[model samples]
Target: MPRKGMRSVFMKSSSPSPSNSPSRSSTIPPLSPRHTFSESLMEENIEIAQSLITKWDSNSQLSEFSNINSLFNGDRSEARQYLNSVKDLQTAMHYFISHNSSSENLVRAQFLMQTAMKRLEKEFYRILSTNRESLDPESVSSRGSTISSLSDFEEDLEDELRTAGESISEVERVSMAAMADLKAIADCMISSGYGKECVKIYKIIRKSIVDEGLYHLGVEKLSLNQVQKMDWNVLELRIKNWLNAVKIAVKTLFYGERILCDHVFSASASIRESCFTEITKEGAMTLFGFPELVAKCKKSSEKMFRTLDLYEAIINLWPEIESIFSYESNSALRTQAINSLVKLGDAVRTMLTDFESSIQKDSSKTSVPGGGVHPLTRYVMNYITFLGDYSEILADIMADWPLTFQSPLPESYFPSSDDDGPFSAISVRLAWLVLVLLCKLDGKAELYKDVALSYLFLANNLQYVVNKVQSSNIKFLLGDNWVAKHEEKVKQYAANYERMGWSKVFSSLPENPKAEISPEQAKSYFKNFNAAFEEAYRKQTSWIVPDPKLRDELKISVARKLVPLYREYYENHRVGLSRECGSESLVRYAPENLNNYLSDLLYGNGGGGSISSSSSSSSSPSRSHGRHGR
Candidate 1:
């Protein structure tokens, strides 16, 4: 029979045993004195507690007895304390296992165990493989042994089939409760539009449970059947929550005070790639049409561009961006994308300049603007200008110069024939005239004259051949009608110039000189004329013509001759006006008007020399004559 005092504490009540329960005992031990425990007596109490713990099918009942024994064993306090601690830990572990034994918890526990084991193994290996010679082998071995003992304890717990089975059932119940609680919280969060927060809480709960159960157990393969049984809708909801979290993170980064712009830039680059893929896959054409989304993207991208420090990154990414320009199905998108790319380029240039300026100014030197203007910008500007100038020249050649030559030559003109035959001669003359006009306009009239004279010689030879061809009835075919048409255009252009006031300048040239001009006088006049022509040409020519050796040589000679005359003109017009107007007025007006008047004198209507002669002597005689003929 059970002892009177021990009956309530140690004796079990009649109850149905769990399936696969351990053998039960009918007799109970007598109670010891409450006070006064000797070492031997304490040892006996510890043994009794161990024996009871070993017999009990349920860990909770075993743990209760162990705690009571610990209170009674006062003399073997340390040993009993260690035993009780182990038992308590084992009981707590059992409770947790029982409450969390759903498939989800099992799977999560296994994963957690694996992760912890990996970390432990890594740390163990790191310590074992360390280079320190002072490491104590005994200490390492003791730690290893402790780990092995814990592993064995977990094995023993697993081997207790009835206890393990009961714990598993309890774990399932607890897991279900936990899942319901989690679901309720998640639903609340979803209703409140705090889905991201819910996801975070759920993650923390899962991790805490998993870490607590599996990290110290070192069990690698726990059951996950219950987890597998959970509704997929939960997972889907979690994923949606995760997506919301990502959106929240992006917004936080964008609005945060930190220079998180670099992160945003990286995010934007990723978003472009990812979202573009979605657009393609989902056939979401309307998404591209959304202006607000596009504007947001553009603003984000611009901000990103502004923050980028690396020029190489810009260059590397520019090609990918350029490819987007070809995707023009959505005009608005295309425009925004293109403009963003342009802004990026500008930003890159700005960054490059800033970086270079920093380098240069390191020693306290001033930096120049346009010093680091990108080669690409320069190339684009030059190409645009060239195209524009070429187009203007084409228009002028087609429309203006040739028509004036259609009227019959006046009787006063020498070599006057019935018809100026095919108008080719007149065209050549007119072209020369146009060239002369250009030189005058350029303030390089003297240089134009020399060049024109050379071209005229060439034209004269060509004309003599044409005459020969006509007289011989050879019917030589000129390659294209460009020459005739170009000449007519030149003539009309010259006539237009006359109407515009060039005739007055032409009338000012020395006419019908009685004496043969001295070589020195001719040279001096040519020199002055050429100098004026070049200056005017540089100022006025819209389309640049490559300077030939002959033109350059003529220019030098003209410059030498005209230096004195220019000085005289400058002295009389500029210096004299400055003296009259005061230095301040001269300074104010000189930058604009002085150069302009000089340009006019050299190229304008009534300059003393003919610019047409210079063009006539050059390769294209007709253009030369037409330039200055009027």
Candidate 2:
């Protein structure tokens, strides 16, 4: 808990202190026994007279005295002196109370004293009801006690409250003066046509309230009350209005406005200077509070990107804003846009990374595979798609930019002429790879197959371009190993596909009329093709197009292999059953054929009637050389 502001006063009072009575040696100090009794009696009489001032003040001071031992020492001289002082203090307090009876201080003072305070406060309230003028119009409300008593019975109540009030008022005056100055600055900023600076100041004040948690205090109170007593539909309408106001303010300040950088002389000379100073002011600090303010700023930044309107504004301004520090002249605005885009991208990337990490680590049932893909992964994918769409739009806009418009290949948007621009392309490729992996894991092999094929085609074309540009040497050294790794991965996938009964879909026949190969041999063909493609890439010193005819031939070969396998599979499965007679019953079963014969019949015969007559007749058991064995 925080320290109490009044603790020091209590501490000082509790410490040992010298007696108030005069020493015997001092001149005219000690009183005779009779004189002391008389003094005490007079002091008692004075207190009784002052007690009639109000029961509230008397009771409050009595209560205060009960809590402190130092207030009542039981010394006659001390009692006499204390009473005289009490009388004087009460006179002044009464004067003020009578004068400003309708002020908040009166209300507080009356509340402090349970009975007489109430009566006095009630009478003061009555005056307000009857009067035409506002009470204490010239005086602001005080936050502390209105009355001080110095009587021995009320010493604890003589708390220097008036002095405290004066000091507080002084501080308040200074703050008000500063606010006036800020208001002047804001006005000057506006009159001088520094609209952005005005908006900036307004935002600062708005944030001061929010960052201080004052906004939350109000919202919390309002929300609780509404939840308890108000209709939800009505409450929602009010909330909507509040949110709309916030949106409008944000839009007015940031959207389609150049004020942040526009005001030349006034903005540069005054607004920036004043804003920084105001931000550092003690009042600003007090109003905004520390750590909370910083936390609020961080939260608001996150929300700024989350807000759809704010995001759209950013997108719209992307072409017009330069990077905060970028020095490039032509693409300054574009660079700024890039910076903002990168910030948003980084946030998204962080979220995705966190989500991915969670999915990997979470052991919850919801994260289990058959249960569903982790919701975090699904959310990340959605965000990734959003990022992709945003990038696409950005790229389209940038395509018309001066530097990009003249380029023959828009693919230059990728860092490499053959790939995408550095940042965007890399991000996209990584996201694509992750999606493909996820799909494959989920048994959505078909989707992965399509993605893999697209990537492969792109990589191939890029390889071709690299060769054409005589850029193969660097690519060969830096990329060949990576390319080999991809090829190995693809081979593994193709093997898996064949194992899953998809060989007929992915296989190809040899165009060179080679003998029929086993499934293992068929897979080896793809591996060999991959190796040759890599070799061709490594050997190219200059631009050389791989023969298109070779590509087509390979496709045809793959198709032929798949077709033959498909026919054989169908024939084996669909062949008619044969009937046999037993001693007492008839039985039927399928007959197995030689692999070569089946292959030849399926592929060589091509489902046409080209089989030899003898073989055709041999298929019929009745015409065959079946001996009647007993």
Candidate 3:
């Protein structure tokens, strides 16, 4: 090898010049010159090199080169001795180079060094291949603390490297042994100036493991055109895989590879950094770049959820990304990760804008039947509630994104105790999204011919919104005050519903129930009361309050206001009317009958179900208790 010739040349150059040479006849004898003493030392160093390195040399007649494992046969002492010999040979070669470059022993030392490196190269590859399971990314990561705990003992590498192979039963111990063995070989090779060969083998083997790990994780490199042109179902599957893969790739696969690379090549910072970067760069870039590519694809409402999921996964894994890929050389991976987050956040914001605009632009003017919940109301509230579940994630995403309102949002819409608190951006954004839906609902309510049903529709839909906010993570972001404010609005809408819906019923009763009137007058008032009550009941029977709590509250409020007065008037007029003909028909409803009708009031029973006492009065038995799912 060129190193042998270099060693000889270097030894020749180490010799003193004639001007600086010691005089042989002065302090030293002429027969024992300085060159002679140096030559003697060089011979002793050569004898040490030959004793240790010759048997392993391939060209030796006594022994042919073979696999190091077979040569050692699980003999750890032999393996360690072999490494020590390589190191000794390296020392002896340095002695020869600096002292006696012209000596023939330099050639033998050079040959032995080459033979030792080749054997170590084989040993490195063997240990890596055979112990792959023990040294896998997950195993290595799980044992990270344990592996680090082995650091204080790394100087005693012979004990660790001796335990290599299945003989050491524990996975962690085997991994430590394999790592130590690799490090020992690497240090020997690097010291002997064979670092390139050591690094090359590591890159080839570990890169394949990384690629295979990613492959099993279902990560793939695709062009923008390929991703964009793919169907959403297919793209969504890929996005899901990427979401799962990114976390493992960063935490386990890349992380473990980083630890292993750093450990094996710990003797050389430059080699470890370059080796790890080259091994993991391609897979990691492809892994992190997937989200950005998905973000660039066609934008749609359904795709936004998956996009948010992608965004959340990346945001959660970012700290590990920075720590693991912290090397300046791995900046591209870090950049790729951050870019994915940016594009995902941008995509989410755009989706929000598009969603809000779609709600504002909704041209559906048809009134919901019987003033029941509008489809738009259901769709928007359900969507908003689900979005509310992602509040924390959206908070991070929208930290810098302020809502752009043409007019400042109504104080009633988003009432916060602290104005412009930390959550203002996402809070106002999500609240305004709900506000847009409410405004759209207000327009739809106008389509109702009966003003009473319009108010009822508003009450039902707004109650749904309030319940959605109160029940989710949105409560944390928007706060209790916001929920209470919207809840009060629900009550106001309900009050209006009762006022407009029951005004005629209220007016039909006499000014005083106790007033004594002739039988003719009493019968006429009773007739009017019956007609008004029936009309109001018929009009309101189909209107719905989907929320059970709001439904019950509205029932109690209406009953509280109207039932007592009607019951008192009914008692006052009943005896007088009874004396006249057909009193039961004139006073068609008892007080209990009115309460029963109110009980069934907001069940959304279609086609204005009968107000008669015979109709079922219980709340809708079939309505799902799961408010959002309903």
lDDT of 1 by residue, 44-120 (tens): 54344344334321234434443234221233233334334333333333333443333243343343333322322
- Please count the clashing residue pairs in each candidate, in the order shown: 76, 13, 1
- Scored by TM-score, the top model is 3
Best-matching candidate per lDDT: 3
Where does model 2 exceed 4 Å of error?
Answer: 1-349, 362-380, 392-429, 432-495, 500-579, 582-630
**Candidate 3 segments exceeding 4 Å error:** 1-41, 64-73, 149-168, 417-421, 606-630
| Model 3 quality (TM-score) | 0.88
Give the Å error, residue 608, model 3: 6.8
TM-score of each candidate structure, all chains considered together? 0.19, 0.26, 0.88
lDDT of 3 by residue, 93-171 (tens): 7777775565577888887778778877777777788888888998888667656646422446545545454554577
Off by over 4 Å in 1: 1-292, 295-630
